[model samples]
Target: MINKHVERANRVITVLFYLGSTLLFILLILSGSINHFPINKFYWLSANTSNIPGAPYDISRWTFWGLCAEKNDKNVCSNYLSPAYPISPKDNFDTTTNLPPSFVSNRSTYFYLTRFDFVFFWLGLIFTGVNTILYIFTFCSYSFTKVVWFLQILASVFTISAVCMQTAAVAMAKNAFKNYGDDVSIGPALMGISWAILFLTICLFFMTGGTFIKKGYKHHQNYVEMSKYKEDALKYQQYMNSTKPINTDNASNPTDPYSLPSTYDEGYQQQNAEKQQQQQPVDIIQKSAGVIQQNPKSSVKFFHFKKTKKIPHNDDGSV
Candidate 1:
């Protein structure tokens, strides 16, 4: 049987995970849109371009929307652009004199990858938002759970794609800088948040899908009742077999639906014997007895016949 408390707890946990994922996604999307405490701090790639004369800033950081140049303790960021282009010395600063060979050779490769990463991130965020809005409806019916599961699947696909693209683009950029003998490092904050969101998304997907396997409350109750009835019937049969001799000859199969109660007593069994016999005629009794004997492990109760009453007939037709 499905415990109501356990079900409620699972729902609460799933909701919490969903909320966490949504919040992280929002944070990721807003990282490069503005220059502020947390946002200005979050970037995918950071490099020391102090020695590169053509480089505009001593230190450059790549964000989701644009690039930021950090000097001293302050950051001077460019205007936010949708689908921001990645940091390529030749493309961004308009000079490639002291840039890495890989940066020039693979400039277009980084550009398209970062752009698609931005796009897929937004797509994933949108799907997650839809799921958040429709999540409450899932509690109203099982059909809504299925709907939410589908939405979770779509969200997972986009989120995974975004994370993969972001990781690939940033890793490639960092490697190029390293190979050029320049000081470079990948941004831990951005990568951490992105991967965290993906983790939450995956967890939510499986939790929502698990609801499909759950049986309804009514179904659980029915199953429990049938199980209890069978248990009681089995116990009674064992008790009777141990206490009394088996009348194999007189024993006839019975087809009656009635079964022995859990707490069997001699008085109660004797009193109900006649009524049980009345309910199941002799033919039914013979059949049921045969069935029970064949399968002694069966839950069907065996009934003992006591006596049958006879009706008197009038001698004359007029009477």
Candidate 2:
């Protein structure tokens, strides 16, 4: 049986792990390393010196949107190829439009990082889902403890990888912007939250390591107890055998203690009879001696009578 406290602790950790993964998933989807286009006009300047003021745009993997300054002293905004954008698309940019070197560099870096980030994100999600299913199995079914532990470790590894990938993506984006001498901002506030959650998840996963240790300790204790009990039982059995009375009779019959053959019984009876005969003479001698001691007067009277009879006979012969 698992200790209740350990079980409860593991449950809490599993819940936290699940929550952290979910929050990180959401943050990864909603927040990107690049928040918006830089505001400065010079940042958008290309090699050509014609100086046609270029638009400021947010470029993402899915779409591009920008605010353009027109000659009429008005601002025009258009979201191109973006279904989620609130505004309608303006005239598409001509193929001849010059693209900024910094924008091109940032775009290349963003796409490269995002591709790997996407891979890690999906891997983390799949592992998290599997871990959740395992948790449910552990709660409802009779799953092996080691199996659950293995699954938890796998989930943790996946989560850590995903967190690392996303962090690297953000770092790469910032580094790219810095290399170009452009001011950059990492945004949505959710990125920090996601990182914090990932840290918490990792901590909880490490904490669950204790559960495995505790279980192994308990198993060792039980094994020791069982071995000690067996030794004690064997000692008790040996002691009982040593103290048990040994029956000398060769008879195999267990129902009767005096189940001897007729010949053996006759021999035993003859031995008893000879012993009584030998003691009879000794008993008779002892009885006679005791009677003489008790009748001392009678013994002396008999001796005197014998002496008188002899003297009378001698006197008659003399007369």
Q: What is the C-alpha lDDT of each candidate?
A: 0.77, 0.49
- The CA lDDT at 290 in model 2 is 89
- Alpha-carbon deviation at 128 in model 1, angstroms: 0.8
What are the per-model numbers of colliding residue pairs?
10, 0
| Model 2 per-residue lDDT tens digits across residues 1-319 | 5678868877787676776666666544432222432211111111111322332343322211222322221222333322222111111222223433434545544444445545555566666556655655555443344565676676677667655655665556455445645544443343565476577657656654555566667778999999999997897678656554533332335565443333345777576557667777887999888888998665645334334433444655773
lDDT for each residue of candidate 1 in 1-319, tens digit (9 for 90 to 100): 4688888998889878888888998888777677787777677888888777766677887777777787553445775344656656667767777788887888888777887878788888888888887878878776776678788889999899989888988888888889889999887888999999988888888887777556345557889999999998898888777665533323333432235543657786676666557756776878988998899878555786689887666877343
Best candidate per TM-score, number? 1
Q: In lDDT terms, which candidate is top?
A: 1
After aligning candidate 1 to the native by TM-score, how far in Å is the CA of 201 from where it should be? 1.1
**What TM-score would each prediction reach against the true structure?**
0.64, 0.47
